[model samples]
Target: MTAPEWIELQLQLPREQCELAEELLLALEASSVTLEDGADQPLLEPAIGERPLWDLVIVKGLFAGDVATAPIEAALAAELPRAPLQQRWVPLDNRDWSQEWKRYFEPIQCGQRLWICPSWMAPPQPDAVNLILDPGLAFGTGSHPTTHLCLRWLEQLPLTGATVIDYGCGSGILGIAALLLGAERVIAVDNDPLALTATADNADNNQIAPERIATYLPEHLPADSGADIVLANILAEPLIQLADTLVALLKPRGQLCLSGLLDSQLEAVTRPYQRAVAFQPPAIEQGWVQIAGTLRG
Candidate 1:
């Protein structure tokens, strides 16, 4: 049996009007709607609970193959008369939409010894420690500058036999990478249940022994828990707020790697920890920075 094709309507508009446009598309019975950066701008380190949009957004709507574009155009004109909208349409062939995005995810090598590869692809460097990953509902696929920075940092560290804590574990990539790099044990923590689940699943996928990695909600972390290394790849605000708590999780002389902040935010994020830890220069990539520090006894 042949499946029905779909039509994708795409329009560019000011960022401020994206919500209105999305609502209108839903009202018009679009099966799905997505927004992308129309100008290919970089959006880095959005705060928790904040939905940062690009200056120009491309709003796309998927509709039934037989739907008429005139009605959609008329509806938009009626609802947003002053909106500067340039609309185009493309026909989408019926296929596995779930797997379609996989085409864009490729194996990425971080620093000297690590590779992040999707499950479907073979490791580009056969001798490197490849972290098998798939794009999921949670974040951290190693493609983002922040994750890339963290991965690079991890690759350079002597993780062998170290105890590590991965706060805000996201997809558990950092913790799992530490495990693969010979960390004796890792404690993966996240506030989101889905992220915890993703971390556990990814760890298992990499054949990490159950005893080597422990998944936890932030509240579930033990009071006496301390690690030789701590990794927190969350945003600046929370990073500042949790400064003491993150530092407390580290053993004396342990290293801390903090990412997911803009270059301009380095001072604000580092100020809280400066009294307790000696920081290295920030590692910057595309306006994002990763701060690494060593805890003082």
Candidate 2:
């Protein structure tokens, strides 16, 4: 069967205006909207929870080929009068759009001992602890600094025989990595059903024993048990809000690793946990920071 083509309407505007453009495009019946750096800016490594973009961004909206471009252009002009909108209409060739982005996601090395490789690719370092993963509807492929921060911390920990709770376990990357690194058991928890599915699928792909890894929704987590380590790679706001709950999930003197925070947000995120845990200096990478600490005994 032949694939259906699409018409992509794009506008070059300041980064601040990209969101508005995306919303306008969606209202105009665009099937999807994406933003890219118009100035070809290098985003080597973005801060945890940061959606890094260039000062100038190109907002692209996709629509069925039959949709008229005139209305979209007219709406942009009317709604975003101040935006120096340089618009273009391009025909997006029919192809597997979902898998096309995979080309850009090569194997990523998180730490000295860990490597995250797409299922289709061969491991660059055969001896390393390779994590077979792919970008999916859920996050965490070891490409994001936040995930890398958590993976690096997991690699350094004495996970052998340890029990872990991967709170907010997007893609289940942290929990899976823990299991592969010799953690006896991991309880993966996430509110998103898609995330739970991805984590389970990835765990199966890795041939991890079903008994070694368990998946649960937030409310379904076993209340009677606590873990030797707790890892949460969610944004700073939620990290602060869930500080008590996360701490309660850990055993006394158990370790906690928190990522998905910008360097500037370090103090605010850490403040909520300080009364109960003693944090070590944060691990900073590309403007992102990971906070790891031990609960007070």
Candidate 3:
């Protein structure tokens, strides 16, 4: 196993220049170039509705040489006007991260009551509420602040035998947690085929009752069936688009938990929801916000 030498090239450009930057990078034959908002930084203070700002990330495999850098620089010069660009080198080893990061995935206690444990980890003391989970590709390990906030809110709610709709059900963590928290049944929704398959595998791993869980994709969400709780942890843009659908899936007075949004993104994400339900200030962690509210009757 060889150590992986990595380089992260970060550049900030006007939002308007995003496409041009992407086009230029592709012309340079860079792989997996990512676009992000500098505003995504925690504690980033920016004006509301500010546009024309974006961050471009171009990563090159180590063997890529000075020849690559020259072309990339020329491309950037042609596209972006003297903006901020950063390039840094990182040293990494071949030790499998699957095992390295796996150690951090132990049983987590949330809301003074709920316990989320990987199937391979020992359950908390019997008196404590336990929810079994296995890592999946999508998201929500109960470790991220957004998920933790949701778990805490779940403890404070009365979900005894209530049906739930777990949107963007990554790792099936939230849905499985809901069941262990006393939801009668949960319908987990995610568009990723792998996520859906993992959800089923996780449900089986936890020995959830045969009829206790059902999983589906976004396009397949049943129009008429609603739930007592709607839990979604995707980012803001998608959440706003799904606003009407999410509200529609909630029975009158049904509850909703929205997460995976940064503090900077809260206003955009919460606007539509606020029109339908009164919500409290979000639970904040590491600059991410998770909001909970009850749907209007």
The local distance difference test score of model 3 is 0.74
Quickly count the clashes in candidate 1: 0
Worst 10 residues of 3 by lDDT: 57-66
Q: Model 3: runs farther than 4 Å from truth?
A: 1-101
Each model's TM-score?
0.78, 0.73, 0.67
Write one digit per residue (lDDT tens) for candidate 2, span 69-89.
Answer: 787788888998575558888
CA-only RMSD, every prediction: 4.5, 5.3, 7.6
Q: Cα miss at 270, model 1 (Å)? A: 1.7
Q: Sort every candidate by lDDT, greatest first.
A: 1, 2, 3
- Candidate 1 lDDT (Cα, whole model)? 0.90
Candidate 3 per-residue lDDT, tens place, 1-297, comes to 443533335566555666666666667665435565555643254321233333443332232322345656666676675554554434435444224446768888998788888777778765788877766665667877778888898887788989999898878888887888888999999988788888888878777885999999888877777999999988788899999999889988888899878888899888988889878777898887889889876
Candidate achieving the largest TM-score: 1
Give one digit per residue, the lDDT tens place, for model 1 in 1-297.
443577888989999888999999999998878899999999975764367999999999888877888999899989974655678988788874435668899999999989999999889888999999998877889988999999999999888899999999999999999999989999999999999999999999999998999999999999999999999999989999999999999998999999989988999999999999999998999898999999987
Q: Tell me the lDDT of candidate 2.
A: 0.87
Per-model C-alpha lDDT, please? 0.90, 0.87, 0.74
Better candidate number, 1 or 3, judged by lDDT:
1
